[model samples]
Target: MLDIFKAIILGIIEGITEFLPISSTGHLYLADYFIKLNQPKSFINMFMVVIQLGAILSVILIYFNKLNPFAPSKSHQEKEATWQLWLKVIIAVLPSVIIGLPLNDWLDKNMTTWQVIAATLIIYGILFIILENYYKKRTPSLTKLNKLSYRIAFFIGCFQVLSLIPGTSRSGATIMGAMLLGTSRFVSTEFSFFLAIPTMLGASVLKLGKYFMIGNAFVGNQLAVLLVGMIVSFLVAYISIKFLLRYVRSHDFKAFGWYRIILGILVIIIGSIFA
Candidate 1:
């Protein structure tokens, strides 16, 4: 029962931070530092990656119509537009796949430490605030997803390669890159969501495969904990996705930037005290 409750807490953390500029994996690492689960190191690692699939499901559910090229309600032109959008997404994901795949193991082993997480959290947080201020006087060149060019999409994917560092949120990196390339906040946010579908799915598959290859199998309450975590994450992520969409329409990401700075400081302090 206690393990199940911990799962719920972790799920909520995942749902809340996964799409936000705040890094979900960073939050998970912090959570584990305090609420150490009574599971094997291997199982715990797999659990964290696999549960993100729940968040991915929420994105698919919310954007089903926009993402689906075969919907009966769409006109031919709209269908074609959807296909083009998908192609752009594929282009945007290539940089991450090419770079992240080769570095996954090394990053997992070396970069998941608190020092790295805190440093990135503070650095990106400062970047967000500075960029938002800089853009205040400038007009966005691209306000709509349809207007986003393939070249811009590819560049945004390059930014996602930074997210392999653990504390650099994937959405945060992509959205910042898109905005730098002159996209409106709404367009940047939406494209970030689209980019997550492939990125998170591929990551979950890789982690799961590695877990099984190591002969790690869920035992006793482990399976139950995993299921509860995923289900809870799915429900919470649905609400989070809706909230972000509404929030970005009327707000800049400066607030998230401030929050990240404060949180990073707290993590550093707490980690030092504990260490």
Candidate 2:
């Protein structure tokens, strides 16, 4: 029962932080450290990655009509545009997929540390604040997904590779990259949502495969824990996605930047004390 409670807390944390510029993985790491789940290291890692599927599904559910090219209610032009969007999403995900596959193990070994997370959180957080201020007076040139060129999409994908460093935050990298490339926050955020579907689904598959290959047996208790986490994350993420979409309309991300910096500092402080 206590373990299940911890799962719920972690799920809530994952759902809330996943869509925000905040790093969900970083938050989960902190949560796990403090709560101390009685699972093996491999199981814990797989649980963390696979539970993100729940958050990803929230985006899919929220934007299903927009993401689906074959929606019966769509006009011909809209369908074509949806297909184009998917193409751009694929383009935006390819760089991470190609580069991330081979580097995964090395990164897991070297980069998944509290110090790295703290540094990235503070660094990207400051960047977000600075960028928000710099662009406050400027108008975005690319307001729509269609306005984004393939080159720009590819560049966004390239930036996503920075997220190979655990706490760098994949959505943070892509959203900042898109904004820097002249795309509006709306388009950048929405594209981030679309891009997450493939990226996270692929991650879940790889993690599951690795778990089995390492001879981790799939059992009832483990299955229950995963399901509980995923379901809770899905529900919380649904509300979070809606909130963020609405929040960005009239605001910039400086608040999130400040939030990240403060959280990073706290993580570092807490980590040092615990260490």
Candidate 1 steric clashes: 0
lDDT of 2 by residue, 178-241 (tens): 8998889998998888888998899888888988997888565777888888899999999998
Report model 1's TM-score to 2 decimal places: 0.98
Worst 10 residues of 2 by lDDT: 218-227
Best by TM-score: 1
Query: Relative to the unseen true structure, what is the C-alpha lDDT of residue 61 in candidate 1, on a scale of 0 to 100?
Result: 97
**Top-scoring candidate (lDDT):** 1
Model 1 weakest lDDT span, ten residues long: 266-275
Provide the lDDT at 20 for model 2: 87
Output candidate 1 Cα RMSD.
Answer: 0.9
* Tens-digit lDDT track of model 1 for 53-78: 99999999999999999999999999
Candidate 1: residue 248 lDDT (0-100): 92
Clash pairs (backbone) in predicted model 2? none
User: What lDDT, from 0 to 1, does candidate 1 have?
Assistant: 0.92
